[model samples]
Target: MRPARQTALEKVLPQIAIESPEAALDFPFTPEKVWLEIGFGNGDALAHWHHEFPNTGFIGCEPFINGVSNFCKLVANDDLKNIRIWNDIAQPLMAALPDASIDRVYLLNSDPWPKKRHHRRRVIQQESLDTLWRIMKPGALLILTTDHQSLAEWMLEQTLRHSKFEWTAKCKADWQTPPEGWLTTRYEGKGAVAGRSQVYLTFRKVDCE
Candidate 1:
């Protein structure tokens, strides 16, 4: 992290850092819903969502030091009070959170791990989906977006195989276009500039007895 970013993180850590799962977030107002964004690169979407939905509490997880610093800077500069961050992988954090606590989850433009051997390392795996299902409320939305064709197919296949989720797309346009109130991210912009089209997949958590 840069010196300025380090300093910024230091000042905002106490307020935005999620020290432990046991610690309750002190939101300025009672949030009607809670959202989680995994691997929020540079936090562009997270910040946009926070700005758009001020009453919804947001928890963002990013293992990269630079990304965390950038998110912290956004939180500080905007005085965003409804956001918390986990500067680490999301699995453990998801485990610690109360069951069915999260209303929505965003996994956008995640690392594709294009090589065949490294597909196991992709974020949208069976185990991770189980964890996500455990944390998400019934009928909650799990939004996934990727510019990589292989990754988009992999995500759809994995989620479709999981009985807990249902694809919400009615037609090709639904998956090809951005959803309502969608916020563009830096990575998505790069993909667009490269003439690579993206896919937006939304899955709903099914109510299972």
Candidate 2:
């Protein structure tokens, strides 16, 4: 990591880090709504949302150390207060959260895990969806974006088949176009330059348990 990033981690991480799953729900600052971003690669979109919705609390789960460091730098630079970092996989935090806790979820540019055998490692699995359904508030939005064709289709199919979520797309253009206030990340930009078409899948949690 660069010197600034390393310094940010040392000085800022402890202030905002979600030390445990139980600690996730306890925010230092009150927020009207809470948003979770799973695998927030490099924290570009997460930081954008935190800036855009200063009153909305944000929880970002990212296991990659470099990504965590980059996000720590953002927090330090911005002095962002309504965000928490879970420097690990999301499942534990999801499990620890009370029912209907999260207001929105972003699973953007997730790892494709393309190989047939590695499909199980994908984040949009049935078990993950089950937990998401339980934790997400009714009518909460679950947004997923991917440039990988196979992964896009997989995410759409998996999310569509889940009974608790309702697909919000009215037509093909809905998925083809980015949602309002979208933040194009580095990976998404690179994929666009490579002539890859991106897909946006949005689902609303309905009839949550």
Candidate 3:
């Protein structure tokens, strides 16, 4: 256990070392709402959003040890208090979090796992979507960006099929650029440098009966 993080995040987790998402909400909070960013590589965008929205708490989930360490490092270096982490599979983490607890989410250029057979390994599957829906508050934004066209289409199709989520793009520009102050992540900045077009998709969760 990372002693520095134990009090607020311990065994609320399963044996898998999850940071009990439920306990996260109950932690001494100063942020007005919680935002979750899945697969936050190196925490660049996480840090950006933390500074940009000082009143919003963030929980970044990344199973990769390296990424989690990098995120922790950035959190310390930047002296950010509005961030916490689940350095494990988001599935169990989401399982512990209260329903409708989250206000916003970001899935940025996630790993494609490009092989057709490896599609199941992708994070944005139906089960994940359903779980995300369960955790997000109604009308909260889910931001997804991808540089791969096929994957982007796949994401769009899945969210479009989901009854509780509404795609909110009005024009090309909505998908062309991210909102101002959006920090360039390691993956996105590289893609832009390589001249790949990026698509930004935003969805809002609808209230359920």
The numbered model that scores best in TM-score is: 2
Model 1 local distance difference test score: 0.88
Position 21, candidate 2: lDDT = 97
Which regions of candidate 3 fall more than 4 Å away from where they truly are?
1-21, 77-80
Which ranges in model 1 have alpha carbons more than 4 Å from their true place? 24-29
* C-alpha TM-score for every candidate: 0.94, 0.97, 0.85
lDDT of 1 by residue, 144-178 (tens): 99999999999999999987899999999999999
lDDT of candidate 3 over 48-157, digit per residue (tens): 78878878888888877666655555555454456677776677778778889899989999888778898888878888889889999989999999999878988888
* CA lDDT of every candidate: 0.88, 0.90, 0.77
Candidate 2 local lDDT, 64-123, one digit each (tens): 989989888877877658889999998898889898899999999999999999999999
Better of 2 and 3 by lDDT: 2
Index of the highest-lDDT prediction: 2
TM-score of 3: 0.85
> Which stretch of 10 consecutive residues in model 1 shows the poorest summed lDDT?
20-29
Better of 2 and 3 by TM-score: 2
